[model samples]
Target: MRAYERLLKYVSYETTSDESSETCPSSPKELVLAEALVEELKQIGVADAHVDKDGYVYGSIPATKGAENEKAIGLIAHMDTAPAMSGANIKPRIIKDYDGADIVLNEKLGVVMDTVTFPHLTNYVGQDLIVTDGTTLLGADDKAGVAEIMTAAAQIIEADAQAGEGSAHGKICIAFTPDEEIGRGADRFDVEHFGADYAYTVDGGMLGEIEFENFNAASAKVHIKGENIHPGEAKNKMKNASLLAMEFNSMLPPAEIPAHTEGYEGFFHLCGMSGDEENAHLDYIVRDHSMDKFLERKAMLERITAYLNQKYGEGTVTLNMKDSYYNMREKLESDMYIVDRAVEAMRENDVEPIIQPIRGGTDGARLSFMGLPCPNLSTGGHNFHGKYEYVCIQSMDKMVDIIKTIVRKSN
Candidate 1:
């Protein structure tokens, strides 16, 4: 089956991960897709295909007789969709040969995807695009990756059956992870048991994109304490916590934010804020590609807290910070050949390699540090995690071929 066809079936299952949930898979619904994937793998001739207790689906295709000693290559993609948008009951429509004009996603909701707001629509003018309705995300973020990998596996098995001894290739390991959108995709991963020398995460955006560098991430929560007083009697004694929270945010560099930064630039994003007269809270996520700069950013948060405490009195502002993940480039630098292999595979499949740094983190970023020198590959998706999300059907088909080439050339 074509990758896009598989994607349509896969997205039918509601697999939106919950960050607030403390469970391993974050949501029990993810296991539904995980089990289905295992069944599909088994049907494709993988004897040991199964979903583990942690909701990770694993299966391996053994090497042909002559290629047994060659290096093992692994393909990885996540199963769960981001919790930022509704993943339930997604209504996807295909735009056959896009006309580079505004697309009315939902006439009733007055939702339109205009070329002026999303100029990248022109890039896929002559290509088929799978897009979401006005209500929900398309789930192409990694489902496209999942479908491409699964289709590649099916093609390899069919080729082996037809060729008898099969086209020369090494062992191919496949894994579909859960909760990647919430950043715990690799938390319980068993790298040693996966039995691959290296892996590639098919969780990136756009066609031909190969990412090895990602942000060094951290999360910060700031709390403010203030005394509430009646408005009529309030004077110099009243200290509003909500106003104090705004002051804390005003201390940050306005230009160094997600809206203003791009490429290699780092940012301090205020993800959420809540406040009242007595107490206030601010949640932020810090990101930088450079480790030194990442550390400096954390220190800057500490400095801000200290200065605020001095100005408002000690114990008034409380800051809590934690590191999320480091740049995978630090771990993959020594094993650069893995990245080169992907580049060659893309070129062999008639796709130009676009090596760029990921503005966001992927499961591969943490996996690389877990002794799996993994880089990231694109799923031919765009505008991930939102209703404007889409994927080029032509690009998804090409990605399947590219994945097949990557594994076959491993011999």
Candidate 2:
């Protein structure tokens, strides 16, 4: 089957990961998709395909006879969709030969994707676009990547069979990870076991995009403790935690927010916050392309917490910061050959290579730090984690060819 068909089948599984869950996959439903993918891989000639206890799917295609000694390359994609939207019962609509106009996702709900807000729609004027139904996300973020890799692998297997001598490629490793949206995709990833000299996370946005550098990420959880008292007596005795949380938010530079930042610019994004007069909590994610700036951003949060604690009490405010991932550029700098190969693959496939810094982190960034030197490739997805999410079917087909080209070039 084609990549688009595989994508349509995969998205129906509802593998939306949960951040609150402590399980390795973060959601039990992810295992269902993982098992199916494993079976598919085995049918595609990856005889060793299997899903691990953590819900990570792994498979390997051996090298061609003459290329047995060549270095192994890995392709990775996440199985779980983001927790920000409902991935269940996704009713996707295919717009063939798009007219470069606004798309009506749900006429009854009056939901539409106007060209003014999404100028990128103009780029895919004549292409087939797969979009959501204005109710749930389409889950094309990495599902497109998964289907592309699977189709490419199947093609390679078929081509090798036709040769009748041996395979026509080097060793190829494939992994479908879960809980990538919750920032734990690499937590239990057995990089050493996967045994790849280099890898790529097919988890980027847009076609022709190649990313090796990403944000140095860290998550901060702010806790505010306050004394509750009657409204009439609240002035001196009561310290409203919710108001304190707002004050804490106000202390940060309003200009250095996600909406105000772009490119290599860093930002402090408030992901979730909730509170009451007795206790309150704020969850923030800090990101920067530069390590120095990332540290500065984290330090700024610490300074704000210290100032608040000094005013309220030593233990009134507590700050907890944990590093999620670092820029993969540092790891890939000495291994430019990997990036060069990807660019050449795209060029050979008639796709322009758009090398840029990723504004967010990927599993590749963490894998690179874990000695994989992994970069990121596009899945042709846009407006991820929302109801209006979509992918270009033609772009996905082209990506399959690109992956095959990369594998052939590696050999």
Candidate 3:
């Protein structure tokens, strides 16, 4: 199948991962798509295609004849969609030759995207686009990446098999992972088993994106214990947990938020907060591109909590903090060619490479630290993980070309 064809089909699988689940795949639904990918990989002539017990699909295409000496290159994409939104029953609309205007997703529901906020629609004018119906996310975040990799790999194999005398330089390793949306995508990746000299995760948004670095991330949750009293007779004896939660938020830097920060800047995002008198909880995610700054942000939180406890009481607050991932640029700096190949490939294809540091984390960031030296490439998506999600078909086709050219020239 073609890249868009595979993308449309993959989105129908509804592999939405569950962050609350204890299973390796997070959600068993992810395995449904993983198994299907393994079958398709085999159909496309990838040897030993199968889904591992941990729900990762691994496949290999042997080197084409003359390209036997080239080092193996790996391409990866995630299987599960984000758990934050509904991934079931996706209705994808293909806009043929898009015109820059307000797109009415569901006419009766009165859903429309303001061009004022998303001016990038002008960039995709005259190109075909696939979007959601405003009810659920389009699942294009990484499905487009998976589709591009699968189609490109199929084409490479076919080209090598047809012209056996002039093949690419080496074998190609491919993987489709589960639970990437939940941050455990690389926990059981088994990088040594995939066996590639270098790799790229086709999980970025927008065309021409070449991401070598991303935010250093950590998640923090604070549970506040409060004394509840009857509102009718409430006085200094009562401490409203909800109000305390608000006070806790107020202690953090106001300007340091995702809505305000961009491009190498750091932020403390308040993901969730809940509870009332007697008990309350606050959830925050801290991110930065620098390790020292990331640590400082976490320490600042600790300091705030300590001060709060000093005034309110020692047992008033409890904190849970965990490090998510670090910047991949540190690892990629030693082997910059991984990023250069992607950039040069875009330049060779007449595409202006948009090299930027990702404000969010990716599977590649953690994978690079795991010794794969991976970078992120574009999957041609926008408005990811929401009802406004969309993908450009032309960008998907171009990504396939980029992957093919990389393999053809790497040999």
| Model 3: colliding residue pairs | 67-168, 67-169, 70-169
Checking candidate 2 for backbone clashes, the offending pairs are none
> Which predicted model would earn the best TM-score?
1
Query: Model 1 TM-score?
Result: 0.92
Per-residue CA lDDT of model 1 for 69-107, tens digit only, reads 888999999999999999999989999999899999999
Off by over 4 Å in 3: 65-69, 164-167, 224-248, 274-280, 309-317, 409-411
Query: lDDT per residue, candidate 3, 92-205, as tens digits?
Result: 999999998889898889979768878898888899999888899999989999999999988887887777554555778899999999889999999999998889999998
- Candidate 1 regions off by >4 Å? 164-166, 227-244, 276-278
Model 1 Cα shift for residue 358 (angstroms): 1.6
The residue ranges of model 2 lying beyond 4 angstroms of the native Cα positions read: 164-167, 224-250, 272-282, 305-316, 409-411
lDDT of each: 0.92, 0.92, 0.89
User: Of the candidates numbered 1 and 2, which has the greater lDDT value?
Assistant: 1
Location of the lowest summed lDDT over 10 successive residues in candidate 2? 161-170
Clash count, candidate 2: 0
Backbone clash count, each prediction separately: 0, 0, 3
lDDT of 2 by residue, 147-189 (tens): 9999999999898878754346789999999999998999999
Error in Å for residue 323 of model 3? 1.0
